[model samples]
Target: MSFSSLLASSQNHLTPDTNNSLTYTLSELSSLPSTSAQFDVDGAYRLLSTGGFDAGKFEEGIAEMDVGERTAQTQNLETFLEARHSAFINLSLKRSQELSAAMASNLTKASRASSWSAEKKRLQTSLLGSRTYQPPPSSPSHTLVVPSTPGLHASTWSANQSFPPLTPSTSTLSQTTLGATPANKVLWGASRTLDSHAHLHYRHTILNETSTPPDTCPGYLDLLSILETVSPNDLATTSLTWLAEQQRSIFQTFVSQKVTSSSTPITSTDFQEYTTSHNITSWHKVWLALRSSLIPQALTTISTITPPSPVLLTRLKTGSGKIGYGTGDIYRTLIGKLLDFENIQGDSPGISNTEDYIFARLHRLTRGGTVRAKKEDLEGLKEEVLSWGVKYFGNVWSFGLPLFCAGGFEEGISAIKESDEKGNVRAVSLAIVAGRRGLVSREFYEEVVVMYCRSIEGGSPRIAMEYLGEVGRERRKEHVKKLILSTRAYAELAGVVGDDGERVGNEGESTPIDLLFGQGEVRDILRECGDALGREGGGGTDAAELYAMAGEYGRVIEVVNKELAVRVDSFKNGVEDPQRNYWKIAAYNFAEKHLNQGRTHVIERLEREDNLKAGSTFQLLMNLTAFFDKFMEGKFGESWTVLDSLGLLPRTAGEVSNCVDNFFSLDKVARDCMGRVVVAGMECLFNLHASLKQDKSQAAGLTQQGSAGGQSLAQQANIDHDKAMRDIRDRGRLIVTFAGLLHGSLGGEVAKLIARMEAYMM
Candidate 1:
């Protein structure tokens, strides 16, 4: 028989009896469980087929026929039997007549019912009423096995043919495994055809019923420990892979709109139970589900990570010095996350309600609204402002400066050292904040001290002074004290020095300070000092002596006044005390006298001769130049040559000629210096001019004083007015001419002289 025919014939043994006996009859024994059964039956039929009896011939021929048939059928029958048995056993199928026809022509019907009696009895005696059985009690089904194993055949029968298993608990599973097995299970049952939906439900129900609580699930900690053992680089690689998966899953969720509404808390008890017991926390599950392929559900979640505050936004907007990434940067980052949370939660119900509340509070605070309405005051507001300021400042300076600088972004950062912030820009400082979020540069502290000093010395010197004094009292902060003191001195000087020269007294007008609308304190201070200086016989050092030494007339007056009031003894000499003041004042005075006398003598000689002084002008010019030159040469003589020898003075060999052109003009020096003191002089001249312009009656007192010396009207006018005008014009002419000669000389030779002269004045 052919394999198909034999397979069909083998199923003949299956027959449903009354009361579900599930037996088989030989007459219609369409199928068999083994090749032996078919062989035995075929042998019996062959034997019975002999009709006529013959002695030797019949016996020999019969034996020969039997041998030939048995040999021929041996291999074929074995192959056919194996096919039939495997089909019946593996498929649990019934055979058909058409299959028998297709197999072989040797089939014959059995007449006796005793043919399948043994098989029927065996089936009846079995514990199960039917051949099909539930899982575990029966041989396991293996229909889903890859490449089709024997176990799978049994499993399929057991699983499909029997009742489902009892529902199992999933609570004991570890969090880490919650999503693992289910995914495999889904893949397994996807192509099922027999009551596919119900089959799936049944399989799931059995697994669920059999599963232990997540907490009892094993391998969760092992996986985490394995993860921990990974190198950071490997971990990062893993994380990247995991993150990609998460993004995909989130995207899937978004597309499916499953996680969109999210009213069912992500933190549900079921989730907690599964995650904890299975070790399948959100991150793990997310990673597991999406690492291979990106899905919409995961992408949505990935996009949602952000910070919460504008303060945070401000910090992270760029890599400026103002903000950075340490504690403060971290805080800002958290705050930014919070802000993002707020935006996401916009009008949604049951969010934490923090970011919006904080935002509102900040808004009110900026608008001058009191935080604690009833208890608020200036101090409270100040405290709040300071709190925020400190947070911002600390964030920007503490962590930002270094990080931004390290990252090649130093635009906003200031010096991170304890030094000046003179050239610092806002962005650079902000970048510093970004780079080193939580640590301040040493410079930041120094800058604070500097600012404090400026505040003290700016609008209110006394306040500044008091503050500095307080700093001084704290002896440990000597540097701070010195800084403040220095700043105070600078502020005081700046305030006093401004426009003080506007007021003049020589022309009979009040001092400019008097004309000023304000500056009461400054005026009072000056007056006190002046009064003290003028007091007769009262001084530690005379004003003249101090002036001669330092040439700081205002300071001299102030010190003299204080000394007089305090009864300090004055220095015995009228001139400066050489040792105490470094002898610079004496040197300066001597230099000035020589310089003035040289100029006056040269000019007088020229005028008297009714001719130019030839190279005398050059000589006089050299005298002015030589003043500083000679002093420097003598004082710093060991370092440099003398002025005349160095060719810096009038070194012309002839009386008239070459070197004359080389002398610097005095006119330019006078013009430039005029910018500094001309106003003072003009104020005096203006008063004089005003007096001259007034009616003769108004000027009668001054006129009478002039006449008291027996001066005629013409003589009075000529000696006083005319002579004064002449002197003014002469000085003016000399200065203007000098300016004309040296206005734009790029060699800066005149500039060097101007600088030297300016230094000498101070």
Candidate 2:
């Protein structure tokens, strides 16, 4: 069979058979070349498995065929496939280029259309002018207009062409009926009309473009009508858009009008008129407009207005309710706006004294109940006023002090301190003034004292002392103590001694130390005088006198035992020797008074002193001291021994009489002393007599209860009793003699007491 015949046979067998199998004879397969031979099997297998045949792979397989065995049929098939693939690629490339060109052309046309539309709008506006445009109908929603010309290049549009203005009949165009027209397009077409209306309204009202008041402007009336027609939600949008167009013109006109009326200035009436004509309803809007426009001119105009006087400022500070302004809020806003204007423009020549103007205004605003000034604003005003005070008066305290007292007490103090070199005193004075006015706290006065102490030296103490006195007057004990301590610390720092009573430098140079030291010296002298009187134990002296005298005497004797004695001796040694005897008599009288009064503490205190105990006069003083102590303790027997040791007891009646007689010539204190001594002696004699009588009675009882031994004891006891009785009698007689002598010497109360004692002894 031929190769074509074999190929046709394979196709027939592969197509379908009764057994569903392909069979080829060996001769038929061997007739084809080997490389070409696999083609039919591979093609059939590839088509069945992959559902398609790869042309390239089929061609590659053909190239790989043995050169000798490769057939013309395979070459022809590969060439046909390559031609078909190339044709398909060329056709696709041509179609893609055509599509790209079409898109590019469409983009170019669209760009031209956009540019032409913009140019058309610009030219139309220029040709027609803004005045000829009419606003769109008022509606809740915005409307957009689209050009009706389809596929018309925007660049070819003529400027002379105009759209018919909307009549009242067409004014009700609803958003639902304006299908597919964008809101932006509608706004753009109507922008000129809106802008023109706003401009006309602003010019007529704010700028007075018609040479008539805003109240009579047709454009302003139209705007007010429009505002009334629009919903509140739309009003804000409408007003804002209107304001956007007229902002620059309105501001310039407001400023120009203000500048022209510099003398009269724009008052609240002017603002009211302006707002009414322009349909401005809110204070917030007014504030915005003023802030945006007439700030500088307003500042100048406000500065020309006469500043409120301090009295008016004070009244306004406390008075409530509106005066000329509408309400507190409106008044506050007005003042705030004026203040803002002034601050922005700075100092104005309209006011000769800018600081005074600011101060007066600030005082009104801050003190007034209507508005509250910020802390920074108050401080800034204070500084301005303080500078003026310092520059003109050469002392900030002149103004600063008064300002603080008025209302800015703390602020005034701080300002003065900052402005003055020697501001401590000024600050302190201001604080004191504030305190006096009850504007400052007790702590403020204390802080002033502390500041003075730490910052100043010499005069600080004196000033602090004055402040302390003021505090004392308030009965602020704690504050007074703090001031004293602070003054003391300052005195120490200044090297001031408390002992120095004289002024350290000039007459006014005395510090707290001098005052304190002088007070102490006076106290010492008073104490010494008290001690002298106390030790003398004068007739008229009470417990207070005795205690004071004892304390003083204790202190004196502590210094030196002989110190007190020397003082007394000096008084004695003077030509007036009677005074010397008076001193001795007073001292002796005090001792006798203590002995009679049963007071041993004074004698005990005197004997306890080491210095006095070691003195040369210790023996006499001790005997005298012991006599009083023992006598007061009811140790009459012991007191007698002390007196006997001192040789105070007279050896005979004549001597005793003489001693007592001499006491009468002494002063009252001395006489009292002698009288007490005689009384003590008589009491001691009476006690001895009682003891003698008891002893005699006991001896008789012993004798009565007798045996031989008892009898001997009784006899001895009787002998002792007899001797004691005799001694008692002798002592009694001696006391009698002493009393008689005292009765003779002392003629007043002393003599009377001595006579009583003599009678008792008898």
Best by TM-score: 2
What is the Cα-based lDDT of residue 366 in candidate 2?
Answer: 23
Evaluated with lDDT, which candidate comes out highest?
2
Give per-residue CA lDDT, model 1, range 15-43, as digits (tens): 32323221112212334443433333223
Candidate 2: where are CA atoms >4 Å away? 1-400, 403-634, 644-649, 661-674, 704-723, 743-762
Clashes by residue pair, model 2: 116-154, 116-155, 144-186, 317-367, 317-368, 589-673, 664-745
- Report the lDDT of model 1 for residue 398: 25
lDDT at 60 for candidate 2? 47
**Range of the 10 consecutive residues with the lowest summed lDDT in candidate 1:** 128-137
Native-to-model Cα distance after best TM-score fit, residue 699 in candidate 1, in Å: 66
> Please, what are the lDDT tens digits per residue for candidate 2 over residues 357-458?
332233233222222344445444445444434333323433432233124556656655566444554455445434443455767655664565445433
